[model samples]
Target: MRCDRIEDLLPAYADSALDPRERAEVEVHLASCPACTSLLACLRAADEALAVFPEVDPGTELRGRLVSIAAPRQKFSLFTLLRKPSLQPVLTAASVLGVVASLYLLNPGRRDFEKNVVRTFHRGVGRVEKLYAQAGGITGSIGSFAENLYASLRSSNPLERDKD
Candidate 1:
């Protein structure tokens, strides 16, 4: 890891909350990195110093306060659906709209895509036909040239044919 990034993670590393792999990585980095080691040492000393704040004893009033604060919070359940009675209609409407929207959005390729594919297919076929015609023309010319060479060789007077 880069020295700057390792230096940034030094505080978290000193806290020992980092995973084993992360701790090893930091350890490897700290071995070669003096700046990060110094930062880690400082964070460690600060944490050790903060440990002096002794835990406060909770009084009877504190217990009452905690219960009062927590008493109104109801446990969650699937039946919470029926309590908000007005939300049900809106949620139902939204769900229907979501279904319609999903069906439209998730539909197969549009007409434009199909049209483009067909057009590309026709263009590719046209190119292939043109290539085939050009090849045929070249091969036909070669065949004619071969025939003329054969006829010329079949003649008894190969040199006299030039005088004609």
Candidate 2:
């Protein structure tokens, strides 16, 4: 194997974490590569230096706080959602809008009013379409004007025009 591949396995080999087959492959590579062997020696030296510092368990309160911080939050609930202060106004507005829409849709006496609303919507849409068509025509004219201006500027030779 290449030195680069063997270099990655050096740390695992130092800790005796690699499987037997992997350990054998790393050993074969390390035998041929002086750099990998030196790296493994350095890792072992660092491990020995670190081993001098004895591991200590954290205090009970600190461990409790850490566990609380890492623990998952309470499961989702609709009551929790409804209790949010920030969402109160939004929920109220949605509720009011729902009531209004249901009332309007469910009213049998407003059948003629609904037809009038539909007619007004159609009329507004027609006006908007006409305005859009006019705007398109205006845009085409502006584009044509710009093209003509650019062509005129390009066609006019300054030297000839000055001589004339």
Candidate 3:
């Protein structure tokens, strides 16, 4: 294989993920190319250095801390509506709906009441207008009668009375 192709496969070869044929090709290139051989050696040395580190262990204090964090959640009952993160939004929405429903129920007739008050006011105005017109007619008739009576008392000429 070409030096470039072998270099591309070098990482996979180091990880042992290459097929037998690909491994053979990389080996052939490594033997022919001194530069690639030295690069492979460096990569292996780096891998070994990385692998030399020991695995991390959680101490008793760390384990106790983790257990304390997890203990409160371990007894979660499936039917417990209060413990779920997903239920908070639903609970909040339900509370809002309940408040709105209660307000609506408490004043169910408020709109009808306002409409009734407005209608009654309009009806009262109409009746008052009718009474005012009737009063004006009555006043005009009384004034006409008084003027006629005074005219008759002041001038009793037959021709004038007939003319009036």
Candidate 4:
């Protein structure tokens, strides 16, 4: 291991916090590196110096403030409910069903609903067929009118007569 890595492990080694494998590695490095051994000695000296001071309990207000800062902040909103991963499929299915029900008027409970739908569909198709027949008739009338107009113009035209 490098000197820098061994330096980082020195504090944990001093506190007896490192696992056996890590402790072995650190020990092996310490045996070879003079700088790391000296750093470990300094860390131990600092720990011994800090041990003399008595620990003090924090005031209630300060403890409460610390707890408030550490605790997660939650904001309530409709968008938050909509954004949940678990609710996505349910919301999507509900909206899809809403659209389908609105468009198709699906009524499974009523026994005659299917028959009514079929009847309405047939009526709509029949209206479409009637409109198409009317359009075809009007197109035929227009064609005949155009042909008659051409014939009348040809009969009255001197240029057309000369050509004949």
The prediction achieving the highest lDDT against the true structure is: 2
By TM-score: ranked, best first: 4, 2, 3, 1
lDDT of 1 by residue, 1-164 (tens): 99888877777787777889988999999899888888888888888988886888899999999999988777786789665888888888999999988876776866676789899999999999999999999999999999999887767576767666
Compared with the true structure, all predictions reach lDDT values of: 0.86, 0.91, 0.88, 0.90
For model 4, the superposed segments whose C-alpha errors exceed 4 Å read: 1-109
lDDT of 2 by residue, 1-164 (tens): 98888888888898899999999999888888888889989989998999897889889999999999999999899999899999999999999999999998899979899789999999999999999999999999999999999878866979756766
The sequence of per-residue lDDT tens digits that candidate 3 reaches over residues 125-164 is: 9999999999999999999999999887758777777776
The list of candidate 3 runs beyond 4 A from truth reads 15-21, 72-164
Better of 1 and 2 by lDDT: 2
Q: Give the TM-score of candidate 1.
A: 0.30
Candidate 3: Cα lDDT at 24: 86
Model 2 spans > 4 angstroms off: 1-102, 105-108, 159-164
Best by TM-score: 4
Clashes of each: 0, 0, 0, 0
lDDT per residue for candidate 4 within 37-128, as digits (tens), equals: 88889898989988887878888999999999999888798999899999999999999999988766654555587778899999999999
lDDT of candidate 1? 0.86
Cα error of candidate 4 at position 50, Å:
34
Which 10-residue window of candidate 3 scores lowest in summed lDDT?
A: 72-81
